[model samples]
Target: MLHKLELIDIKTHKITKIEFKKGLNVLHGDNGTGKSSVLEMIGFVLFDFLPENQADYVRETHSDKPEYGKVRVWITDIKGEPYIIERTVGKPGVIVKDALTKSRIPEIRGVNQLKAWIGRNILPMHEIELGKLFDSSIGIPQGTFINPFLRREGDRKAYFDPIMQLGVYEKVFKNLNELNKKFEPDVQGVSETIHEIIGEIKIKEELLQEQESLNAEIISLAKKLTKSESKSKGLKEKYKEIKKIKEQIDEAQKKLDELNIKSEKENENLIDMDSQLRDANTAKQICDETKEAYNKHIKLSSNLEILEQEFEKLNAYKEDLRINNENYIKESTHLKQLEEVLKKAETNKKKLPKLERIYQEHSELVNKIKEIEATIVEINAKEEQQVKLEEKASNISKNIKSLKETLVELPELVKKYNIMKDIELRIKEHEIDVANLTNQLEFFKNNQEKINQHKCPFVDQTCKNLGEGTFNEDIFNNKIKTKEISLQDIEKQIEKEKEEIHEKEIFREKMDILEKDKTTIENYKAQYRDYQDEIKALKEEVRIKPQVIKDKKE
Candidate 1:
């Protein structure tokens, strides 16, 4: 059996020393002292129990606060040999020492090292008949776990029988008889073997208990499996219902897709109609612009013709002036010749002054003759110039009258060209516009039947209840609106838009009629201007008179 225990620096104590004696050593100390801790350390150092109480004296009172503590214990071995087991906190690990010399042992230097060392030296108290083999308060035995190894064979036999007689596993007859009394006290099986030992019978009963425990575990596991299978079946049924609902949703989606395709076809037709209408309007506008430009060009050409007539009249007046200039040149030549005669007369009058009155009178008569001759020459030249000027003036007047008549005709030609072109282009444009509008109107009319036949109803659900049916609109409207717009409101708005567009089309038609009437009036005005110009030019030509001149001497 084991002997003394000594504690140093172990739990709840700092540097406290304790000692124990052999056989029964009871330790008593106040709470928070090292008494129980000393018992725990001895049990660990000797029999490998109470590992947590190994030898650390310090621990963290709270996780946030820690105390570093160390512990060492002295225990006696089976032959009364002493050894020290030492432990410290804050990283230096376990240490085991020779008790007498206080020198450390190498093998017992880890946290679990002490457990292995003790297991080599000690038998657990429960495995032995601990109460009979060792003391209760302190576990040192009288003839304990150590004694079996130390004693002689005869001594060992004595220890074994006494312990065997007291334990749950004893001889067969004793155990069987005990069970028999408990189960059937007054009855005994006859002719059966009675040689079974009590210890063997007791072993058989232990086997039966083990089988009973195993059977109970099997039953519990089977019940759990059955519950799990039922739950699996219920979940499968729910999955099947969910699959059916998905199929219904898919069918609804396919129907909605067909409706959408029909609606798209209708929309395409409507779009084509709208595009055609816009193209027709554009063509009409282009034609009207072209006609207006042609009319403007015609007006400009008429103004150019009038300007040419005025230029021709100015040219004729220049020609008459040239003829009068020839008359002026002849008159100048006659005046020079008359001046020479008068100078000769003056000279003769100066030389014959001695002849008196006759010479002077003759000189005066010559001077008069010269002056009269100069006057006659001037008059004849004037007459000649007037005749040539009158002839030129008549030619100029004839040319002016001819030009006026041609100019009047030009205005009529320009007006006629403009009116005809305007009327022809306008008629062509109106025909094209009418064709386009008719095609567009026909397209819309043809598609309207298909659009009405295949309209899809929009469906929704308002609540999560299983029995509730889907919600939908009764009357379908083909137009798509913004998310915030109500469907019923859009249906009403569509009718109003249709009426407004129809009114615009009617107004366009009336404007086309007015344009045709304006073109006709313009043509009439051009023709009237041409006739008036021709009549006025003819009258001016008739009203002109010819020039005349009388003969004269030079």
Candidate 2:
């Protein structure tokens, strides 16, 4: 409730002040005595609006027109700070000032800052006609008339809805009660018994996994035994074949050594031809050197003849050049004297025209520049005054535009405010409904244990609805199977396989050595044959040079 209200310089009046009472108070007078405007003035100050046609809309739209629509309100604080709320209308912008400090308050749109201030600092008007409460008119006393608080068509569903919800609450309660009756002892015993059974099942599962891993290991070892048996048999057969081949090779080598000695005696004449071929090669090298020097002497004589011809040509050209030099010097001196006279004549010819054109252009441009500078100075002088007027005009125009916008927004503001009031009423009804629902929820929360443990008649269906307590055996079985492959069991199998691979690798290395031994034996047999041939050839060389061989022996 407003404690006091004052209107100052609002519309036609220069100044007006009014006071208000704390309790329910009405501002009343005959129809056109500015009584309605007083309410408008209160709205303007505390809420910011004025009735239509109370003030001239045109003059009010200018920012500088006047602060004629100012209103002030004084209120008591039941909560926090209280001050007179002042609002200025009929200006470009609305001004809301806190009376105590004289500082302006920020204007809030959509939500009322002034009303919120009152809510925080003073008692908010309590609303009793919550739409849902006592919704049916039958609840009211028959002939004791009640004040109309809202339109008859205003939604009253909130008052009737909770009555309908009692059925839902009844169903929830009946289910809960039945659930509790069947629960208690069975739930208490099963919870403990189920935990013990699950513990035993977990132990059994671990034992089953260990037994399965041992079985897998036994099977793997059996396969390894079968493969090892096969490889051992193959190695024995190859060893026998290698021994037999070695015997046959030994017999052949003995027969070849005997034949090699007879063949060397038949090849002794072929060795003597190589000595004659060496002397013929020495004579051919001496002949090649003597031919190269004879060609060098002939090339030097041809170069001497060319030099004699060039000497005669130089002697004739020198005499001709001496005669030309004397004539050139004489002509050059005469030409220089003529060139000097021509330059002087040309200089005088160019000076008069070039200077006259320069003076004419300079005189013209100097006069033109002076006129431009004077014009620039004149424009500069007026710039300051023009700027001042432009600033003033701009400020006035901006203020006028702002005032017009606020005036135009006035109707919208009232419409929004009314809509907001309706929303607040609806919200109050919802709050009551929510409070009732919360009370019902507390009843359920207080009985949770009984509900969770109840042997529901539709246990499966209840589980389906509640999404609880369904054990997936297939997923669990697959998981158990996966767990059966213990890491230790896998590591043991890996070690056995690695050991088998290592044994096979060693066997492969032995086979490789056997193959290399065969190659080395073959190469040694070939080298022995070559060494025998060289010994026979050296004996033949000693027979051909017997004296040299005899001297070496001495």
Candidate 3:
């Protein structure tokens, strides 16, 4: 219910206030006295439409410069809560406020907000459009009731659809038709995919047949490889036996070489032994002479050792006597010094009380100084705290000033932020729309031919009724290119796997050969060690043979 309407400076006429009653109201006036202007203002405020120019509503009796005209409508909601809606003539915005709270309802800016506000607070959406609602139900315009009787049948039905609320059913049917159109393409694409899969199945069957033939050939090769491996194994065993025999022969040859070396060393040793035998008598004679001379030297050395021992005893006794004399001299000097020190101690004992008194005074003064220093340190700390507090207060003042300035601009900033947020929301909605379009494009590309063949159930043209646009052949070509790249990748992966398998087989064969070579090397190393041991023994025997012969000669 409209409780009040206030208008300012409206076309040489100003309506300051107009009040209405609860149930029924009437306005009757002369033709030029602005009777219809009130209804026009009501339509402009509520339904955002006016029969006359909004600028003409400006008062001509006002100042020469056009002044802003305003319309404020006060209405009661369904719950009887009062709301005030204000609009300025020739302005682009409206303001809605809670009359009780006097607080503005934010976000009521343009026609959409006004409509939504009216729907939520004053009337239902269909009733908020006063022209339509009045024409259809409550109040008929001058010619509206007679026009439908004169119209054609189709036109009459069209006019009646909104009155009977049959347009909603038409919208629902249209949406269902669009949904069916969208699904038809998907169904056709699926059918085409099934056909492609069937064709691939036939190709796979042929490949399987070829694979079976390859498997047979592989089995034949495997049998041949097994036979070759068996032959190689037998040959390796024979080679091993031959290697062992060769090692034995080499060992025998090494021993023969050692025997020959030993024989030659022994013959040389025989010659050296005979020469030593001849020199044996002469060496024994020389040894006897050296023994006689050694006995005389031993007797002389014993007499000299006895004399030297007696001389050392006499020298030790003299050294002891000299040490005693030096100690007696040191004791006499020390005793003299001690007597002098005793006299000095006696002299200093008289001054001990005075020194003790001075020390006590000095200790008292040191404690007093420390106490004074502690007090000074505490005072400095308080002064520093006072300085810090002053700085803090200055900072707080600056912050308060800044806060006041920010508060002044807060409303405008909030409004801008809201506008930016709305723009961001719109951008995000557009991004979502783009993403949906991209997905639809990709879908069509992936199934272009199939979608192209799909026909709309309601329309004769293929894909004509689709909610999304028709398939793009360029996108389909790109999808084919992508699939081709993927196929190439798969082929490369298969080839890489085959090469890896071949390399692994080659590595295994090499490992087998290495194992055999390692065994052969270990056997050879053991044989070489045995040969070295035999050579060492032969050399030792050759060295001792001459020693034995020399002992026998002796």
Candidate 4:
């Protein structure tokens, strides 16, 4: 029970102190006269209860000046000892003490601490328990009493679950139901797995039967494989002999190709030497012809020197004339340029007055245009400002339209949010269901034999009537091995074909090279013969040169 409540400068109301008796105490006052406020303060000091309009209780209202205040309550313990608990508004600490003994109780530094201390040491019950008791009994707000009854069953359960301590029991019941739900899938999965295992067992038995037949077939195939291996051995021996012969042929061919190449080069060198010999004979004939021309040139040399002196004097006179002509042309061009300049100056002088008049007019027009442009600029500035203002107005209108649209859709959006929350909750529930079912399924899959033996409570029937599938395991393995052998054989054949093709291509390339070398050698031999014939002709022609030139040459 609250013994007393003291408010100092709290909301600045007129009533500052209130005393309560041992029995029921009632606070009756007009509205806005601190009747409800006093009750709220009592609840706050005792249990840290805050009102919806808590700012009103803390705000200064009486004067313009700001002030700090406190809400202090005297609470009586179960032994009837009075304790003062005070909480300063807008402050960080709480003070609790023995009122009669005037000894300070241990201070609590926070609202939670103070509430905890009061609930433990001063109050007859825990704070939450007392609050529930008070709310259900004497402290019922208007309309709250009937609200629970009006709510849905789930909502009502939520409200009362904590008060009745039924949450744990409900959670346990839900978990059990979930476990049971999980067991159902487990039972079904176990049935299926048991059937599968039975089928596998039957298949293994069938495979054992098939293995006997496959063994006979394997013996036949092994005999055939031995014959093929023996044949392959004979082929390998023959192939090795063929390979040795081919290698010998390649070596002989290589030596023949080298000899052909050397012969072609020698032929080329012979042709080149023969060509050089022809060139030398031609040079000798040329030298003989040049000797005759040299004699003529010596006879005319003195006359040519005198003519060259005269030609030099004439060339000097011609160069002087060319210089005079260039000077004359330059002067004439300068005179023409001066005349054109003078003519242009005269024309400009004649147009000066008119130009000055035009300049004055242009200046006046420019000044007028500047004034007009300034006016236009001012107008454009105003227009730009108007455009900006219009844009702002348009933006404001758009904002208003958007706000109206939002207002129109707010209820629907809120409904969607609530629906989404409900869906999320349902999804979570379903996920848990899925997890339980999956776990049960996995358990069943792992423990199929147990389920088939009726060891699981959820499984009522065994998988005795289920059909077991059969598989020929040994036959399947033998087929796989056969396919692998076939694949290897095919790969070996492909590699052999590739090697043969490569050898054939090399042989063809070598034949082509040998043919080209032969053609080159033939061409070089023919060229050598032609050069030798030309050298003989040249030598004969030189030997038949005029006796006079020949004596000079000797």
Candidate 5:
């Protein structure tokens, strides 16, 4: 029974695996989706079959040529004995492996051998009978897949027997006999992988959020630019306002600069505004000379002038300090008050040294406090830097995780690339052999009679395969057959190599991307280390905070 199908680099399929269940297995898709191709792969893996050129089985790719296309199928006989059937294009042999142990069975090394062995072991038929039986039935006519099953008995068997060998193998073989292979892909350390995957998802979400925020900022900035342009005139006016000075102050300053009080000529300009503003003596002289009203007509000038003369006489008693002192002093009270004042002065003098000491201590305390405050400010600044470093490290951790995953894949790709290179070398060797043999074969046919017996028809200076048998008519025919087969195999290998190499090249291109990120990961690591160093320093500062406060209190 057909159990599972695996295809690699086969026509339109790159890498795909399909598991068959208890019921119907449907290949449903549009045209050129490789629906029929899947059926072909299953049949090929089972019977070691190729309906067309083997080169066509390998996938077409854009990067470099591939060396092989592969197909694998798991099946079992009526006894529930499990086996794996494996086939590869660009390589020889049909490998039938034990499904349990994955070791090759010694028999069935070739296509005919595989069919013969399958007939003998699993069914009661010869290779030719098996071929005849399957040839008409296994093609899987498109659109009529289920129609044959809808028909009765013999008609249904024609379409279905080739797939499962159900006619003689009974229900167990029809059910694919407990090989029951299911494709369940899992990673080692799956829990850790899940955590990492979750972390990556979170990081990606954060980045998306940040991108949205930046887009918002861009929109906001554009709006601000428009608003700023509209208010340009107001801003310009405010900027101009900065340079303005009060004209009144400026005028007064200018007047002060021109003021020259040393000469009467300068005074003439000063009196030009207020002529009635006279010198005091000059006004007094005028008042004494004419006993008239001060500003306008008034007749009491004589009495007021006598009173002003008496007020002026008080300045004559300025030298009578003895009498002033005697009037100020009381004999009993003066000496006692002076003694009390002296004692208080002595007391204040005695307290001055203590006050100075207290002042000094306070100054030192204030300075120590200021120093602690400065240390605190510095610690805060570094702590902010530490926070920024952590955020940056977080971003790099995400990057490093991604790069490491890629790195894990690089070694496998490189291994494949090396294998492809070896295949290319092999292809070249085969091509050279084919070219030389082709030249010899062409020469031998053209100049057959000119060469003597056993002198070598193609060689004797023309063909250089020295120890090889002479090119007689029989040998010639055999060579032709050998050449045709060799050419076919070489052609298939070359075409398949081209496709496989392209795929390997695609994987190699990722090595370039990986190398680029390799440097980036290194830089990130260096930066992360620096962040750790700075954070550690900040932590040390934080640790000192309590001690600093304790010292400050003391």
Candidate 6:
């Protein structure tokens, strides 16, 4: 039952309110007195559509186009609760409010949702049933009752098809009901139990992982145990060999001790030989002096015999000569024994050639010692040269390594340069796209009315659907928003590419520097090789130096 009806800016009724009684309601009017228009408004408010042309909902005005129009119906549902259903022109929303609280029902958002909600909750029928009842039963058009059999077959089928599909829905609902019943008859703790089972499964998986790890550990330990056994067995053999080696070492130590004692005795004998050589040199010098003096004494003795003959001729000293004649005889005997000693000294002097030979050999050994010292000095010089060459080689190696590292990066840097170029080109293209889209969006916004007069009014460019002269407001607005969004998107892409190009540009600079450094690699390599050759020659010289000194010593 409709409790009230309200109309604003509708056909022939700018503002009208009508109240209906609880049992019955009637509209008393003549023809063309706006009765049918009120019925259309009721149908439009209740069913979200006018039973007649849709445009009839807009107010019929003698002025320009109307801006707003609405129809509201206050009705009592089957439970005797009053509610309001409202619909407005140019808006797709249908409002249903609790008449008691006057609060809008947010659940009934659009016309379709409200229809579905009314069918499901308010009436035990579909939305199409309400439309059929309103069209054919409640507000049957003026003379439609005369058409008993002239209804089109398609119209009858369209009406009957939804009814026929109820059987399928019945079967579907039957199956769904069974499925619902087959669910747990008692689901009091099912979710908790499921959670507990899942936790147990997770714990079981964890324990399995732990068991696997422990098994792997056991296998690894077993392998280590086998290795340890092998090592222990080898260690026992090594211990035996070490014991034998200890015995051999003890024997070698005894030999070394004996050799050390022998060396000490030989050193003592060398000291004795050195002393004997010195003594022999001193005796040769004394022998040479004694032989020369004995010759002088012989000469003097001949002279003295002549002088004594002269003394026999002089009788004045004859008495003094008789007093010391015994002493003079003793002196002559001493001189004869000294001449015999001189003869033995001359025999000793005959070995002076052998002493000279020994001295010449000693001089040769000193020369050999000097040569050995020179060889050592040469070895020191060679080692110093070797060290300098090694330093040079090390420096060359460092340079080579630096060059290698730089060369390695050159390819990647070049690749980055190429990538940066590609990104720069892409960024330019994207920026161009952004500019084009911005122009299109601006042209559409600025020339909206002119475009609508000509074509779809949605885009700046000419479209295929020309000359249709139809306008869809939603499509027009959405197309504008989409173009602007695309412009923004392309601009954002250009910004991102600019950032990428910046990073690649930095890499390109690095590539340039490294590429220039690539020429030095061969130079460093050549220097390294030359240094290595020089080091090899110096090492050879150092190696033979000790042997040269040894040959000199020998």
Highest-scoring model, TM-score: 5
Q: How many residue pairs clash in each candidate?
A: 6, 3, 1, 0, 14, 0
Candidate 3 matches the true fold with a TM-score of: 0.31
Model 2 Cα lDDT, one tens digit per residue, 1-554: 56677666665444667766556766566654566556556544444343354346222334566534656677656654546665655553344455578776543332254544443445353322222223233123334334333423112233344445665678899999999889978998999999999999999999999999999999999899999988988988898898878877887887777667656754664565566567667766765767677567668767877787787778778877886787788779878988998999889788979889999998987776666555445444444444554455455455545545445544554455445444443444444444444433443332332235432322312334234646332443343344344433544554554443444334434545544544554554455455445545544443434453343344
Cα lDDT tens digits for candidate 6, 240-298: 99999999999999999999999999999999999999999999898787988888999
Estimate the TM-score of every prediction.
Answer: 0.21, 0.22, 0.31, 0.29, 0.35, 0.29
Error of 1 at 52 (Å): 6.5
Model 2, residue pairs in steric clash: 10-68, 132-158, 132-159
Best by lDDT: 6
Q: Report the Cα lDDT for residue 507, model 3.
A: 44
Worst 10 residues of 3 by lDDT: 427-436
- Cand. 6 TM to true fold: 0.29
Cα lDDT for residue 267, candidate 6 = 100
* Poorly placed runs, candidate 3 (over 4 Å): 62-65, 126-145, 169-554
- True-structure Cα RMSD, model 4: 41.1
Residues 27-137, model 5: lDDT tens digits: 788889898788777656555455777887788889876888888888876678888888887677578888999888764557755664575556644313443344456
Alpha-carbon shift of residue 378 in model 6 (angstroms): 99
Report lDDT (CA) for all predictions: 0.55, 0.54, 0.68, 0.64, 0.70, 0.75
lDDT of 3 by residue, 428-520 (tens): 334334333434444445356544566442233467434466535355667656655655554455455444344433443454455455555
A best-first ranking of the candidates according to their TM-score comes to 5, 3, 4, 6, 2, 1
Clashing pairs for predicted structure model 1, backbone only: 171-198, 171-199, 172-197, 172-198, 172-199, 173-198
Candidate 2 regions exceeding 4 Å error are 21-28, 47-68, 91-98, 103-112, 123-554
With candidate 6 superimposed using the best TM-score fit, by how many Å does residue 131's alpha carbon deviate from the native?
Answer: 3.0
